[model samples]
Target chain A: MDNSDFKGKNILIVGLGLMGCSFADAFRDLYPQKIYGFDINKEITNYAQQKGLIDEGLTKINSAILGECDFVMICLYLDDAVQFICKNMDGFKKGCIITDIVGVKRKIVSSVQEVLRDDIDYIPGHPMAGKERQGFGYADKKIFKGKNYILTPTKFNKSDNVDYLEKIIKAIGFENVVYTDPEKHDEKIAFTSQLCHVIASSMVDINVDDDISNYEGGSFQDMTRIAMINSKMWSELFIANKDKLVNVLDNFLTSIESFKMLIEKEDPKLIDKLDIIKKSRESL
Target chain B: MDNSDFKGKNILIVGLGLMGCSFADAFRDLYPQKIYGFDINKEITNYAQQKGLIDEGLTKINSAILGECDFVMICLYLDDAVQFICKNMDGFKKGCIITDIVGVKRKIVSSVQEVLRDDIDYIPGHPMAGKERQGFGYADKKIFKGKNYILTPTKFNKSDNVDYLEKIIKAIGFENVVYTDPEKHDEKIAFTSQLCHVIASSMVDINVDDDISNYEGGSFQDMTRIAMINSKMWSELFIANKDKLVNVLDNFLTSIESFKMLIEKEDPKLIDKLDIIKKSRESL
Candidate 1:
């Protein structure tokens, strides 16, 4: 299927939460077609429908209703993603490309593939954009305006399916798209995303009891800006992808230990190491 | 002396680093008068003079010349602050109010006071402002704009001297001015400034080899932003304020250990703890 195949197609966004509702709004605005939504919470689903984020709101995913949709986008919790895919297998149409907004792709992709038939192609994608504030009210149309959209499509996936998903993502106003292996994507995220949340959380916890109301400067604010992210969601996501997170954490702890040793020794050579890191940070 | 005392007063800024030069620029622009500067490196002093960051830059402090100055603002390395005051004690006037922009005051405030005569009041003040980029060239005139300026003046400091420093800091564009004890100031900075630097440096060192140019987003950049701080300068500062920094490090490490435990157990209960910290972070 080409870009024109998406022109009049029906799209279903499961889970009417922040990412789900955002997906519906983005596709509905750009695709010039109907966008449906499903969520466990009827209130959210109805609200999204009223706000024109979705054309239809459903409390349950039924085969009769989902069979009408050309594409299904799973926007659920990391751990719950595989379960949702398994339960809603019969709802998707034949040859429809399924994709996800899950942060980590390694396990979710594999688990989804295990349950779905070979005829149904699945392409995993993660939009590297979000805010500390969640919910449909906080969902922004400009969230992916200039963000990178990584498409993790396996060899089993057809070229047409990958192309179809890419067109949809591009139409949604994402600035860049990269096709990467699922394992590599998870590793990149471990260093870039998971490690960042851990460091912010750690820093915030360090000054948990301190009376820093009037003392904190811009640097502290900038560093801990993401500390307000939903911890329940983050903690779930953290453990769901534990192996990579643990590896990244080990690398971070080792570097910090070396720095502490340098500080303890009052060694001037610490500057050499810091200069190397500083150069890299600046380059990035 | 009152706020009007600074109208024609000659001021000496005793360091020409980023914060020092920024202080000079901030004050020089607002004071509309002569500002003298001294640095161990003649180049920095000369640069400050050439850049108009200071009116007079000198390699040596001459008592006859310095005695004419009304206020001496010491902005130097924490370790060298006491030595600087001691060596230049004979150069300053009898009733001159000596203030500092040092980070750790509990570490050196008493030592600095010990070197100065009773007639010369020492008010330990730390202006919570600066940029990662160092030197006089990167010094911005509005570095202190809307930022907090903290004055940790001891009881021995005259009320007029404290008020004068406050007025000067406010005139330089600081929106908030806070007063606290020296020991409390050091403890607060240990948590906010020192521990944050260590965390940032360590986190950056973790992915120093990663190709972060493409995948690193806002969160990763924010987490490691302060890793660009001068290691030589921070190394000296850490050792100079070893006791307080070490204490803060211990507490920080303890918090990190708690996080590691949360990960190990994959406990959902830890979200409550994270929620409390996140709320505290938002309030700050």
Candidate 2:
């Protein structure tokens, strides 16, 4: 493998939505090569090309273009991304390294490994970066700057491929690149990312009937800011990591129940719980 | 009662903590009168007086200074505020209107009404404004600006007394002074204020073992901002409003359970729940 330069290499980005376009925008200056994009939405593809975020926009998936690419990044939803790879696995060039930026990792890693050709590399990557809003209009190259990027590689992945992917991530401005097994990545994210959204959404759902505008303070606003979520994307992610998410959700409910019990009994232990939480937060 | 000029009137503020000093700082420019302050912590009283947030600092709860005040504001914890008022009920000037900025209203209102002299009026007030930090050091006059000020006045409260308290709240720069009964105040606050803290604390408690700094985003920060709470103050508020807080907590847990069930079943209804939360947040 030529590790010296990727200046003339071709990179194809599947799904020209926020994450895909963001990757194109971030890599455009670093790669110094052709950036091609494909989206199910023709308008997004056209916009990406017009905005110069990509060198070429694929109206239809073409094997010739796919076969010529040195790198492939799939940014579609979990199901679409898996199906796209399985359906077009033949189109990928030999030794080409493919990656993704999906929230969930274990399922995608398993699916990709199931049908992946021995010559090709599939490295599952997740960038802990996003906004509550979506679409290409909100895409920005700076989204990945200083953000944490996790790479979950199975036994099928080659060390050279992982190193190349890390170099690409670094070139795109990610300061922290962590390597973790797929299961650990999914479990930790269930608490850090998915659980917070569930709590925010639940908080918002209950206060919908109340005239909260008149009496809400900073705490309420902070807790519910993420309640304005992208439903379709989140639902897919939630379902993809159901076991871990459900476990975290159950543990969260247990914590809340303990609080309720303390309050119900008017127990002095309530202060201890608060102190524990405060101390935990200080550690963060 | 003369409503025209309060220039010659005296105002006594008990508990020279954040809320008390904040009221004094906010009201100093609005009311042309002597603002006296008293706290169990004599140092806070002295500091408040030295900072000119209060005109006179009471070393002890003297009846002479208390009898001359036309308005009294109590800013103590639920139990302490109740005990202080009951202990000093006879020291207050005749026909003076007393108010409080306690988070929970029902318990305080009931306690005050039970021991308050007929010559004095008690109106329960709660300013929906605060920071996670405590004490007079964090006090700021602008904390109340444009924030909601709720007055939970029962039938025992005189109409004129409610109007007079509203004027004081307005003078403190609160634009929205809402009037509701004590029960309603407790119920709404359980959802809007108290429950948020509980959710934040619980979220912090669960993620304590995880190294969140590596992957945390804006949502995590926003959700846990209130986790750095004043343990004693919040525990008291949670206990005082236990029934209401527990009710809201139960409903919130049910909402979480519903989300969990949807995720467990991989139901499409999860999207609908997310949309509902998103729409509700937009209303705010």
What is the number of residue pairs that collide in model 2? 0
**Model 2, residue A49: C-alpha shift (Å):** 2.7
lDDT digits (tens) for residues B32-101 of candidate 1: 4578898878888888888878888888877877888888888787777778888877777889888888
**Model 2 in CAPRI terms: which quality?**
medium
Clashing pairs in 1: none
- Residue B99 CA displacement from its true place in model 1, Å: 1.4
Off by over 4 Å in 2: A1-6, A155-164, A167-173, A208-210, B1-9, B155-164, B208-210
**lDDT of each structure?**
0.79, 0.86
Every model's DockQ: 0.58, 0.66
True contacts kept of each: 0.61, 0.84
Clash count (model 1, backbone only): 0
Clashing pairs in 2: none
Candidate 2 C-alpha lDDT tens digits along B9-28:
78888888888898888878
Q: Write the per-residue lDDT of candidate 2 for residues A190-262, one digit (tens) a residue.
A: 9888999999898887774557777777677777778888899899999999999999999899999999998
